[model samples]
Target: MYETFYGLNGKPFSLSPDPNFYFASRGHQRVLSYLRYGIHQGEGFVVVTGEIGAGKTTLIKTLVNELSGDTDFVIGQIASTQLEASDLAESVALAFGVSNEGLSRSQIFNRLQGYLTQRRLEGKRALLIVDEAQNMPYSTLEELRMLTNHQVGDRQMLQACLVGQGELRARLQEKRMEQLRQRAVAFCHLGPMSQEETQGYIKHRLQRVGWKGRPELHQDALDSIYSETQGIPRRINTLADRIFLVAYLEEKEMVDRDLVTEVARELAEEQPSASDESEAALAGTQKMVSGQGEELMEQRLSAVEERMGSLEKLMDCRSLAKALIQSLQRT
Candidate 1:
């Protein structure tokens, strides 16, 4: 909605990963270099792990884009779920466009091996990229390692890249994963951007989408954003997106610290933290209990008032009857 007002060609801070918006931050650049080096080696696993929304997928996408024109590489990618060993093989086959309909586990493996072999004969190296690989069980990961064992002569017919969250690294360090670890040509962990990188990232994305500084981001505002999001690319995108929207709504050209702070506060309220949710829940429960107590007290007070009124009426009637008796006796 704010794109036109901000004189932008598209959404700069979109949540979706796009290669066009890839910023070569220090950490991202190092990971990219590692990936390129691993791919050049062309025969083993290249493992990349990061926190959620740490741009691991985007880095891979960027590398793929750079390699799109190369005819020597046949790349297949899949985002893994919690898959069993056989399911993992099937998923790998399907990712490379090999049909697995009605096929048994061995049959699927044979087909995948044949596909990789065919690619090798065609003078192209097949690369399998498994994203979210941390979801796979140990058996499934072992299956992945076994897939790398497919050989055509001395050269292996396939290479694999495992991309997942930090837990994948931890899991790979276990004793059972020694075989897979031995075959890893490259392993890299992507960390969050530094504060300076965070500022550059926001400006880089904005510039990519034709931002000419109409909605100027002040330094204090940038600082506030970094403080709010802590240099995570995804979080920065989210908060910056909201900040721009707020600026557009308020018809302001310059975004200062106060505006960013206000927007951040609003976002915090909208998406409460775990602690915030717990506190709110407790407060709500207490309010309900207090309300019930007040209602019970009101009911008791009404009952007491009714009883007092009845007693007053009874006493007045008795007095009137006594006065009548006295008059009669005097007569």
Candidate 2:
């Protein structure tokens, strides 16, 4: 919505992991290097872990884009969602475009091996990228390790990259995961961008979408955004998108610290924490009780006023009657 107002070609802060908007932050660059090294080796596994929204997907997408022209590599990607051991083999097969319909577990494995062998014979290496791999069970990971056993002499027919959250690192450290760990050729943890990197990241994305500085971002505003989002790329994108929308709505050309802070507070209020929700509920209950008490007090006061009014009218009638009787006697 704000793209036209900001004189941009597209949404700069979109949450979708587009390779065009990939910013080479320090951590991302390191992990990307590791991925390149793994691909060059063409054997074993490459493991990458990071916090949610830490740009792991973006890094992988960037790598894929760079290798798009290479005919030697065949990449297949899948996002794991708590897949069991038996289901994982079939999922891998499907990801690589191998039909495993009506196939048993062993049949699926055989089909996958045949597919990898074919690719090897064609002089092209097959790479399987498992995203959100922290959701995969230990048994599933062992299956992946077993797939690496399909080798032609010293060269393995397949390589795997496991991308997931930080928990994947912990899982790999467990005693049961020693075999998989041994197969990992490169491993790296992608961390959040530094504050300076965060600034560069925003500007980089903005420039990518044809931003010519019409809607200028003040340094103070950038700092405020970093403070609010803690240098996480995804968080920054969410806040920055909202900030631009607010600026466009207000018809402002410059985004200042006050504006960033106001937008951040609004975003926080929209998604309150559990403790905040509880406190708000308690305050609402107290207000309702207080309002009820005030209503009851007003009703009692009205009743007392009506009774007093009736008594005053009765007293006035008695006085007038007494006065008439005295006047008649005197007459």
Give lDDT for model 2.
0.92
Alpha carbon lDDT of residue 37, candidate 1? Answer: 98
Per-residue C-alpha lDDT of model 1 across residues 61-172, encoded as one tens digit per residue:
9999888789999889998888888687788888889999998988988898888888888888888999999998999899888878878988898899999999999999
lDDT of each: 0.92, 0.92
Score residue 208 of candidate 1 by CA lDDT: 94
Clashing pairs in 1: none
* Per-residue lDDT over 69-130 for candidate 2, one digit per residue giving the tens place of the 0 to 100 score: 89998888999998888787788899889998898989998898899888898899999999
Instruction: State candidate 2's TM-score.
Output: 0.82
Report model 1's TM-score to 2 decimal places. 0.82
